[model samples]
Structure formats: structure tokens, C-alpha cells
Target: MEHRYLGNSGLKISEITYGNWLTHGSQVENDTASKCVHAALDAGISTFDTADVYANTVAEQVLGDALKGQRRESLEIFTKVYFPTGPKGHNDTGLSRKHMMESIDGSLRRLGTDYVDLYQAHRYDYETPLEETMQAFADIVRAGKALYIGVSEWNADQLRAAHHLAKDLGIQLVSNQPQYNMLWRVIEERVVPTSKELGISQIVWSPIAQGALTGKYKPGQPVPAGSRATDEDGGGAESIRSRYLHDDKLTAVANLEPIAAELGITMAQLAIAWVLANDNVATALVGASRPEQIASNAEAAGVTLDTGVLSRIDDVLGDLPETDPNKTQSPATRLT
Candidate 1:
């Protein structure tokens, strides 16, 4: 896979990062997850993204086992904090210093690693002071637990404040992870500009809009069996339905079939390539329960989309994409 520098940092990561969010320890068996991770490595993917809260921390354990034999220096491992993982308690979650300290130790123990390449805040902690959160991150870096820091789904204002604090604390905050796809452009308006100005690149997740852009969920058809839309666990179906399962969105996605055929790529590849077309996007994150899925999606890396193809995508998905700057919101209370 092609690699790029994450923001202005010297660290280089694969353009296509394999992520285990809902699949590793929840949707798929451990053996299946291992196969998928192997497939990613075979495809030359050197970056892996996971979170401590994913599958109640089972995902990290499964990923660590899957990556056990590889040369750790050759791979970039990323995980996040700011979510409840252990038994519910006042200090069990959020980005407070106590929670971050406890969480990083637990994450390292579960991931079987002494240090992670990047540690991110899963969300902006409205309850914790920004200074406390950034200072804790600085301490994590100073302690050699994580090399760099990042934030996920943070608004432009939140990012600016954190970036300033990170600079003041001598922390290298190099990336921001956001939900960016052909169907979701919420990051394009303000977050992208602010992050770019702050020397931070974006590691975007859900480039396929949870498989809606793949045209697998046909408009007006029954939800496909075995698809995330049909998954009963983890509110998967409900989440997709609320955002991308609408008839209008599905129909718009279907209209891109000929475009994908003309380009000799799958709809999924087309969607991923579209996200990578942005210069500020350092990587596009993809999650899979099966090995073949990673093999196919990895091809999107280094595959450049021409201007006409991009225009066609915009024409088809016109006005359906959410670009509201105000949509980048954090929960008032920490998520359980």
C-alpha cells in the first residue's frame, strides 16, 4: 500500500488503514478476524486502528494476537481513549487524567505492546477541562506510551483549542480521525480547513458510509442478509438506517454503478478513492469481517480518480451529503 506522512509529522502510514471496530471481537470470530488481519498485511497495509472501547476491549486483544509475530517497528498501531471499557465507575471513562492514566495501562496490557504509534481521544470530553485532557495526553507521550496524539470527531473549535494546548505542552498532535465519505462531508467545511492549518492530517473512517455506497443495499429492497444493516447486535442496523439507509441515499448510490464499471472498480473502491483524493486526508480507514473484503478495498489506495469521475460522484450525490459545520458535535455526557 502507498504510504504518506501523517500531517507534518515524520511518521508515515499506509494510505489504506485496516480498522477493527465492530467486526473483530463482536461480529466475527477470532479466527475470521485473524484471517482478515493477515489479508491486510498481505495487501501491504502497515497501519491498524482500534479503540479500547471496541467490543469492550476484546477487539484490542484479538488484534494484538493477530499481529503478534510481525516486526512491531514496521507497523503503526493506533488506539483511542475516552470511552468506558471496564466496570462502570466515575473514573472508568472520559479524558480526565486519572481515567487516561488507567486507560493507557489497560490498553497496553490488552494490546501486548509497550507503546502505540498514536493514541487518540475517541471524542471531545465536554465534562473535562481541555487543559486537563491535553496535559494528560502530553504526559502519555512523555512517558513513552504513545508517540503522537490525535482526536476523533472533534469540531473545528475543539481541535483548535486542543492543538494550541498541545503546542504549549510540546505535544505532537498530528492527526484527526473523522467520519468522511462521499455521503458524509461534515468534515469538509470547517474541520478540514482548521486541521490543515494546524498541520494535522485526517484519518477518515466509514468511507463507504457503512456499505451504503457499495450499492449492496438496493433501494426499496429487503435489507441484505449478513450485511451490517441486518446485524442485530450493537445497534448496527439502527445506526445505518438513521444516516444512510434512506431510499434517496440508496438510489443515489445506485446511480454510481456505471461510473464504477467505467472505472473498472467496485463501488466501494470508488468511494474510498474519492476520500483519498483530498490532499489533507492521510488515510482512509476500512473495517471488514472477511478477508476478501480487505483485499478488495486495499486496491483503492494509490488509485487516483480523475476530475470527471469526481464530478460524476458529486452530481449523483448532490445535496445528499451532510456538510454542516455545526454537525460536529460532542455528547454532553460521556458515552457509556
Candidate 2:
């Protein structure tokens, strides 16, 4: 896999990263998770992104278990804070110093790592003061528990503010994990521009829109058996089989069949290549339940999309959706 510098931070990351959101504990079995991890590593994917909230922390444990015997120093491991891992108690979540301190310890324990390459805040916590959050992150970096700090799902303004706060305090805010894909163009406006200006790289999650772009589900047909769409509450919060995920404007799976055949690439490869077209994106984190999924995704890092193909894709994505389906927060109202 191709590698890129994660913002101005000295860390280099694989262009295609593996994520353990719906894959490790929620969907895939232990052996399957091992295959997925092996596929990623064999494909030169060194970055593995997980979070404390994913599968209630089972994701991290599974990932750690998968990476156990291999060389640890070569991989870039990332995990996030925020999101309640415990009950509804205030200490269970948010970016406060106490919560962050406790949370990182728990994360380290679960991931079987003493320190993380990058530690991110899962979301902007209005409940915590900015100082408290930034200082907590800074302290982690100072203590060598975290090499770089990042924010996930935070808007452009919040990201820039965090970057400035880190700069002022001598902490390096390296990357911002956002949901960016062909179907989710929300970051094309504010967040991308702001992150580019501040030299913060965008590590996009759900580059394939939770496998929707993979041509797995046929519209007007029964949901693919055992697919994420089968989840009662939706496999993921944003993946509730919406109109955007349908086979409507984006020319569905059938539309891309010819293109995939021509390029000898899958529809998922096209979607991932499109997301990585932006230089600001340090990595596109894709989830995988099966080893083939990881192998297929990692191949996308090498696929090239010419102007004609990109325009055809643009036409397919015409006008674009104002609302980002993958994101919990709307970019327009996120800062407001």
C-alpha cells in the first residue's frame, strides 16, 4: 500500500488503513479477524484504526490479539476516546482530563499496547471545556502515551481550534478522522479546506459507505443476507439502508459492472480510489469482516482513476447530497 505523511506529524501511515468497527467483534469471528489482519499486513497496510466504543471495546482486543506475534514497531496503531464505554455516568465518557486519562489506560489495556501512535477524540464534547480537552490530549503526548492526537467527527472550526490549541501548547494534532466517500461529499467544503489550511490530514472512515458502494445490495431486492443492512438498528448508525445507499442516482451496482470489468477492479476499488484522490486524505479506513474484503480494499490503493472515469463518477454523483449520511453531525450545523 502507498504511504503518506500524516499531516505535519512525522508519522507515516499507509494510504489504506484497516478499521475494526463492525468487523472484528460485532461481525467477524476470531479466525476471520485474524485473516483480515493478515491480509492487511501482507498487503502492506500498517495502520490499524480502532476505538474504545467499537463493539464495546472488543474490537481493540481482537485487533491486538491478531497483531500479537508480529513486529509491533512497524505498525501504526490508532484508537479513540469519547463515547460511553460504561454506564451513563459523566466519568464514563467525553474528553475531560480524568475521563481521557482513564479511557486511554483502558484502551492501552485492551489493545495490549503501552502507547498509541495516534489517539483521537471520537466526537466534539460540548460538555467538556476546550482547555480541559486540549490539555488532556497534550498531557498524553507529553507523557509519551500518545505520539500524536487527533479528532474525529469534529467540524472544521473545531478542528482548527484544536490544532491551534495544540500548537499553542506544543502538542501535535496530526490527523482528523472524518467520513468521506463518493456518496458522502460533506467534507468537500469546510472541513477539508480548514484541515488543509492547518496542515491536518483527514483520515477518512467508511470510504465505501459501509459496503454500499461494493455492489453487495441490489435495490428493490431483499437485503443481502447477513449484510450490515440486515441489522435491525442498522449495522452502523449511519448505514440504515438510506436512499443514498440505494441503486438510484449513483447508478447502482449494475452501472459500475461494466467499468469494474473493464478496469479489472471491483466497484469497491473505484469508490476507494475516488476517496483517495484527494491529497489531503492521509488514509482511507475501510472495515472488513472477511480476509478477501481486506485484500480487495488494499488493492484499491493502487488503482488509478483517469479524468474521464472521475467525470463519469461525478455525473453519477451529480449535485451531491447536501446531508452527509455517514456522519452523525451535519457539517453545516456542526460548528453552529
Top candidate, metric lDDT: 1
Model 2 score (lDDT): 0.82
- Candidate 1 backbone collisions, by pair: none
Best by TM-score: 1
- Predictions in order: lDDT: 0.93, 0.82
lDDT of 2 by residue, 177-202 (tens): 88877777787778888888898999
lDDT by residue (1-336, candidate 1, tens digit) is 899999889999999999999898988999999999999999999999999999999999999999999999999999999988878677888999999999899889889999999999999999999999999999999999999999999999999999999999999999999999998899888999998899999999999989999999988999888888877788378879889999999999999999999989999999999999999999999998889999999999999998988998899989999888888787889976
Residue ranges of candidate 1 with Cα displaced over 4 Å: none
Q: After superposition, how far is residue 150 of candidate 2 from its true place, in Å?
A: 0.6
